[model samples]
Target: MSLPDIKEALNEYEFKWKAEQVTIQATLLKEHSDGRVTGDITITTQAKEYHPHIHQSQFNFSAGRTRETLAKTLHSRVPDLISLKQWEDIIEQLCVKIVAMIREGEPALELAIDDTKNIPPEYLLEPILLKGLPTIIYGEKGANKSTLSILFSICMLLPWKDNPLGLVCPTRSIKSLILDWEQDKEIVQYQAKCLKDGMNLPYFDVYYRHCARPLANDLPQIARNISKVGAEVIIIDSLGAACGGELNKPGPALDFFAALRELRIASIILAQTSKDTESKKKTVFGSTYFTYYARSVFELVKADEIDKTSSDIALFNREANYSARHDPIGFHLTYNGTGIMVQRQDVNIGQFIKRHSTQQAIYEVLKRGAMKPKEIAKETGENENAVRVALSRMKAAGKIVMTDQGYGLLSKDIMQ
Candidate 1:
């Protein structure tokens, strides 16, 4: 029997082989870690009314089990759907072509290093986001992590220069996408509109998708979507749903990180903080890989001050791979029925950092007029000994002035 030539589609993940009135399509091809090529092969007819002879089922490169299953299913379910000999020929061609496709690319190549100090790590937003790497922001639900991403997308989409947010956009303009797992398209749409209208900028598009499947399972479709829009960056609304389920397990974490690596695009991933009151430590809520694999990480915090129209938000740098972790970035947000606005501001240092560090708490108390160590302890809710120790260190560091009045800031801007 002559074998039909299988035609590879423009998308490397798809292939087709035609025989008689039926077309066999192999799609969503993936190479496993063990080097096995697996995909779905559907047998369909080119008729006015569409019906699948063998609805898509997963098949490996060898196609032995799949071929037998297809044959048995056809013979038992619907007799003589296709001749046995024709089926054998299609399976043989399919196996050969699948093997070739799986083995197409070189595993490794010669190193190409043209110069020393040639290229520095590129940044989409300096100190916050590295270009083409994942950045994580995890916090309590109402901390506005998702809102921050939306604003970042706007900054890049509008190509804001001397941006009010204090983060520089290195490129002229960036194309971005949003994959929302926790929210619907309508919510994101309204948020985008309110933000843009508040800034008084003309409307523009930022590609968006509402996602449900695990990123690893849905990479091909996501890749196609990214390619279609020429998106340079992606914002995954939250991490818990993106890993599918059982996010605490190592497998999902590994798979999620691998999927992001395969994506090869700049990303801002929002995550939830693990509820750990005992340690007073906040991790990315699920797997440690969510924090470890990410190129940069931040803990988002909203101030305790009650403001109906505004939020005092800060992104505290937790980790950075390319450089030192930075001082927290402070942004003030004001929103109402018709508009939303974000602007750079000094962190409301006292309330936001008080719980995390005794130094910060002491610093906050001393920012007002000078006070004795005993007074500082009472004001900051700390032990007198601890406050005394901190004050001694602060004086040695030239951060506080010692006077008849007691300890105080050398100047208001001393910390800066």
Candidate 2:
């Protein structure tokens, strides 16, 4: 009948509460003659002061119900009366507590086991440039490095068949962005026209930002633009012009690469080689950081007897982290009447001649008839030991046969 009497009756119930800062107060509001009790409960939080945080809600129970039953009923129903904002605040507090617990190392780290087989690296060009990885294409001045970079961009932007360099595009189509900091708008436009006309495409899926702001200062905007265009691959033409500080310095170089990694897109960074550095290792014009961070590195060098402006160029795979180094591939950047075009030479004479000179000489000598190793060496003017090595290799490759008379071509069908 009285509030104190009702409180005393409810205190006998063994109701376990989870929140130490919260309290519930129940009052008997009415008593029905047919042995029913109607009441309301007020839920509040207690600090130094009591704060009514939840709206009061009615509860009904039979007169004969035990304190345990009443407490349990109230416990279950009180949560429903809490406001949405109160619930959100409670969840935020719990999250903060959980974060603190984690920081205190209450829970051990979790390990996830993946049963899937290891996947191979995905590449734009097999063994050369991988998807979602950074690559550096560096060359001496006038090596047509920009042309090569443009070719790559064109390949990625247009249909695979339109790719003049014959690079394999894993996807049906790829959107590419070219941030050309070195070239002017007119030059870039001309180059783009040439690529479009040469590929015989009305237009390409490529976007170009000719002569962009320096990379060091405008990385955020560049990253946003890449995302805005949904670019799968981005090319930064000429790292020196894009970068703000000296490229030879580690701080600037690292910062530049860090910005690139943040874009999370496959990137090709074009750079110039230092003069007087003929060797591939020293030619990359920046700090070792560039090579260290790059997933692959390629060098383009002008072939001997070729004019600096000539289309003939040699591409050498200097580094490949995911795949074996590919032999140098020859590319000619010729201009048709309509546009500039790149064509892969049928034969990579530089690599072919370097790797197979002895084999070629031996084969030429054997073209006439079978001959002993000494006779082959004397006829070909090759070292006797070298001839023996070449003969052994050729024999194992089924290119040649040794009979009682001498060694001879296994089949005349072999190409010279």
The local distance difference test score of each candidate is 0.77, 0.64
The local lDDT score (0 to 100) that residue 294 gets in candidate 2 is: 88
RMSD of each: 4.5, 19.1
Cα shift from native, residue 165, model 2 (Å): 2.5
The lowest-lDDT stretch of 10 consecutive residues in candidate 2 is: 1-10
Give me candidate 2's TM-score against the actual structure.
0.57
Q: Show model 2 residue runs off by greater than 4 Å.
A: 1-114, 162-164, 211-213, 277-282, 304-310, 346-416
Residue-level lDDT of model 2, residues 74-149, one tens digit each, is: 3454545444444434433422332342234225788666997878888875544688999888877777777677
* Residue lDDT tens for model 1, 1-416: 44454565432333344444456677666777787788776766554354556466777876477766665664454345567666666666667777786667537778789766777789887767788999998888898888789988888877876778888786678888999889998888888888888878776886899898877777777887998988889999888888877877787888888778878899999998887844434678887878889989998978875868988988888888888788778888898769988889977666575424566677766766778888888877777898788888878988778889888887754555
lDDT of 1 at 296: 94
lDDT of 2 at 217: 56
TM-score of every prediction relative to native: 0.81, 0.57
